[model samples]
Target: MTQFEINSDISVARCLSPSFYLDDVYFESSRDHIFSRTWQFAGLKSDADNIRPVTLLEGFLDEPLIVTYDGELRCFSNVCTHRGNLLVSESCRGASIRCGYHGRKFDLSGKFLSMPEFEGVRDFPGPEDDLAGLEIREVAGLMFVAFDPAGSFEEFFGPTLGRLADFENSNTAVSTSVYEVNAHWALYCENYLEGFHIPYVHKSLNRELDFASYDIRTFRFSSLQTAVPAELEKDSGRRQEFDGKAAFYYFVFPNLMFNFYPWGLSVNVVEPLSPTRTRVRYVTLETDPSKRKTGAGSDLERVEAEDQRIVESVQKGIGSRLYKPGRYSVKQEIGTHHFHRLIAEFMNQGGAR
Candidate 1:
């Protein structure tokens, strides 16, 4: 077993070991030790459908789930209890969920309703006959589910929960896109944890923000990185809308980003496909149409392309035999350092909390 240790002091700490990214053993370990125990964005909430089926972290954890809304929203296993068959094929309104294989029935609340041709069986319907209900939390019009979360929802999202209040019922999704990157999922997230590469990788985005005043704040399970518009640096009066902030980037461990811009929110969900391949889903919601194409949020696809290029290059570099872990920049890489520490803490723990 390869153990990862990141120093507590930023000035003395180094990045996560290259083995953590390049080794299959570590990748497999994280599937249960890290991703399985953290909150993940299932999907955006919708009133149009009463029962929505979602596969949590498809291609990775691959846990099938169903989010049903009666008067309130709840999440349950999409698998049938009797024969382990899938219950819901798609999102639709129905009075009950019946297993196609055995006709084991479950109500919207995931309680066992009835089963056919089982009258003679003793102790047939018990606690295990009902669908397993999982823990779910709603934040900013997005639904997040966890099998066994290491911490409470408030501990994970408390620092920035108030910042997203206005978007609770108002996520007007304009577009959704998926980008495939031939790099480790953590590499993509590591690149996102800092603005140090913005000047070198994202020339267009670098021009929009004041790099000197870039701010980073880390919480127990989340971090915030704020960028100020270059124009706002000149005239501080116009920056009052969102405290003169051009972009509010919030990263919730282990793979969710809530990016708030003047125009709207872009929710980025990073899904690990394999040790070297990852899928990034971009959900673009427009909150202010007038502010579109104006600031740090504009031309997002181009920015993503630039990020992909550099991250892929790093993926290749880390595989070299002579390569070694590098030190972190105390001022510019706090978010990245915090993320590494959390990964180390979870990997070293005995089991999920």
Candidate 2:
């Protein structure tokens, strides 16, 4: 592990070594130490709707998991209980998950139901025969799961959840066009943590947001970046339309971003696909049913494309041999420092149980 002098000096809080971003060994270690223990946004509540016996959500952060709803919502290791065959092929509704390999069956709640070819084997169906259960939690319409049960979901996600309570209470339904982007997951997160690069990287976005009034504040394992128009600049002020209104970009530690606009919210869940690749799933939740197709929120596809271009370039740059760790602009990147520290803490704790 890379060691640093932890003191009052903001200069010491520069990003992790370039190796942390480039090395495969470091990436694998981070997956075990940090990602496994962290709470990951799995899917939206709408994804878990109806009487679907099995909902196969390809796991983020290297742990394969599936959420199911028969009578009760449950999360289980996607690896089958018998012979280690993967249970569900895709998202579909069924009475139970039947292993395609050997037809071993499991109920929606991950309880061992029955197996066809195990009649002669004594103690064939035991606890080991049941799908491994994972802790599942929900905030608003978002469903989250932690591979490690010992880690508290509330402790990890409380701040963002509290901030989102009011918007959730408005009962916003997810917009159908859920956009997905490819980039390094942490790159996406680091970008969202602060507005430092917005003016230079996001020309169109910079015009929309007031950079002078943009401020970032940190709360344990979470951070909020507030962007208000220069005209209506105050510590706190409200606007009618989302065009020049206050936008709160909330970064819940590890991988979730809740971007609050006047119209509604945009939830970005960053999922690491590989050492160098990632998928950002953007789910837009809108309360104003009629205004969904208009205003600032409507141009999501363009905004996402802009973000992808910049992040992908950064990903390529971080891998270069010439690159090393650099200083953080104390004025601009305190939130990013806080994020790196939290990541260090989680990783230093070692793997979760």
Candidate 3:
């Protein structure tokens, strides 16, 4: 059944089915059912010097999309209305977008401006000739785009913006690293959703964090995982006032992770390549450059290596005939439970969007 139900009370709830991790049919269905309706990171407002065309979820959605600006920035389908040729093949600055194929032109804001050789066309330059615009929301320099979204921007990400109100100004570019992992996309996400494996999986990280005091707080479409540093680590007095000497990890709904440290913000985006493969992008925004050398955020490469290896191993193990769903560690699995419920609810919905 598509209705993969989970009990509201975590006390006796079973984990998500093994089939959800293995079947190609389910994997393909999730693209339209879940990802298409969710808000996705398009690019940063500060990312371009001019009008830029970007593909949404490149390998998966592969939707031709363009982000352009005149006085106002807009995100619209990048396909030419007359011939379906890509409108903007590269990042370039111009007052308007012109398809190289047939010279159909649109304003930078995506309004149909002119078309050559279409003088006799019926209903010429109607709304259909204009580039179709998607639902886009811009906040804190990040551009988010979604198609027939299941929820509003505020409903999906309001709490995150509220907590990170001070971060809006650090919209500058930073280091970005992308890693390809041989793991289920959800496996990478489930591992990131909770901190239960930190003590066992991340030895160096465990040293800086106080295990007993670490906590997970859940929201409507997101969850926050916070770890108070060990007393000696905190006593060093290098942290900023934000998060009050704790490292905050915010997991937004399905696949995005915002990791905050005194060093800055780390945006980890999990992109599905196939049912058993995933691409994880680590983007670092250094608000406080000096803090990069220490604490839970430091040595990210080492930590990422550790997380990736284990997740890949789980990817292999999940396909076993003997495999079965297990129980949740009620105290520590709050975020995973919330995630599973969302998967079920969203996936159960039809692929209309």
Which candidate leads in lDDT?
1
Tens digits of per-residue lDDT, candidate 3, 125-229, equal: 799889899987776666788887777877777468775566777644578889999989999998988789999899999988888888998887788899887
Clashing pairs in 2: none
Tens-place lDDT per residue, model 1, 104-147, is 88999899999999989997788988899999888777789887
Clash tally, candidates in order: 1, 0, 0
Which 10-residue span in candidate 1 carries the lowest summed lDDT? 166-175
Better of 1 and 2 by TM-score: 1
lDDT, model 3, position 25: 84
Tell me the tens digit of each residue's lDDT in model 2 across 277-296: 77676787877667545434
lDDT score, residue 234, model 2?
Answer: 48
Full-model lDDT, candidate 2: 0.70
Best by TM-score: 1
- Candidate 1 yields a Cα-based lDDT of 0.88
Comparing 2 with 3 on TM-score, the higher-scoring candidate is 3
lDDT of each: 0.88, 0.70, 0.82
Q: What is the TM-score of each candidate against the true structure?
A: 0.97, 0.82, 0.94
